[model samples]
Target: MRLSNRNNKPLFSFIYSLVGIIFILGVIAYVLEISKFDVFGKKAWILLAIPSLLFLLLYILGRPVFEYDSDGEALNFRNNHILYILARKDAKDEFPKYKLLKFNIINVFVFKRLYVYILSKKNHIVILKYDINYLSKKQIKDLKFSLNKVVKANKEIRHEHEDNTVAV
Candidate 1:
């Protein structure tokens, strides 16, 4: 899916911007606290340091963006960089689009708080997340439609295979 500018996210942008402002102020406070002046008290360290640490955590993991393609769904999980296909356990189809043919066309869907990565039969399976507020109303609906259609197809095809099951 197309991701607009990061600054367009209202709450996310506000929180990140607040974190930056707090961090800069915290640095200034630390310098003042250790300077030759008595402007900052011992309690200044606790006050500034505590919230700064908390907000730093928020700044790091609060917003995540995923890019999907035939290669794999890409994301930074923790400190590890990951890119791979996770086939669905329930779908027993062995062929599973054995080539990169499906990778050329990847679909993005929005469900509740999720960014569904509907990567056709060949690209394996993946899903994702991001705020819809960063997109227009039309974009949101289009994403939702794409995801729902793929999910429905997944159900029908999987069910058909199940009914034709054979014993080894």
Candidate 2:
């Protein structure tokens, strides 16, 4: 499966835009206050400009990006300058016989976490916790799909083996 980049959450984009607006307003307020001073007004403006510029830079560059391709056998995640590569084999090894039951975005404090639940054929359950920043929303969903498919295929193979043994 290939996921397109057009499916980003609109709410997050709105919030980021709001934060940029607030930073710009703060810069304007500081400049206006400094102009009231007779001397050293430029210094106050400079101080305000420094942080405002930094905030804008961070807001633009910190957005999450994701790429998922089942045929390629790996999921690629990029946030800012950090990159994470998760191979299909690695994920299969980790969960083994568990099937992905459900997943969602859960908020904790200042961060968003992804909570994934998996059910094993033996009735055992496994919960996987991942920070949302580690992967894009689309990548998360695609990974879940891939994992579930693998689990089901493995289970079918096991069932066929058991049936053959019983017939013999």
Tell me the TM-score of each prediction against the true structure.
Answer: 0.42, 0.36
Q: lDDT for every model?
A: 0.42, 0.52
List residue ranges in candidate 2 displaced over 4 A: 6-21, 34-62, 78-110, 113-143, 151-168
Clashes of each: 1, 0
Model 1, span 26-137: residue lDDT tens: 7777777778555656656864776678665553332323222212233221111111121111111112222112112223452223333435555566543333333456
Candidate 2 C-alpha lDDT tens digits along 51-140: 677565444333343333434433332222221221111121234332545556665444555555667668777665544453555666
Instruction: Tell me which residue pairs clash in candidate 2.
Output: none
lDDT of model 2 at position 23:
72
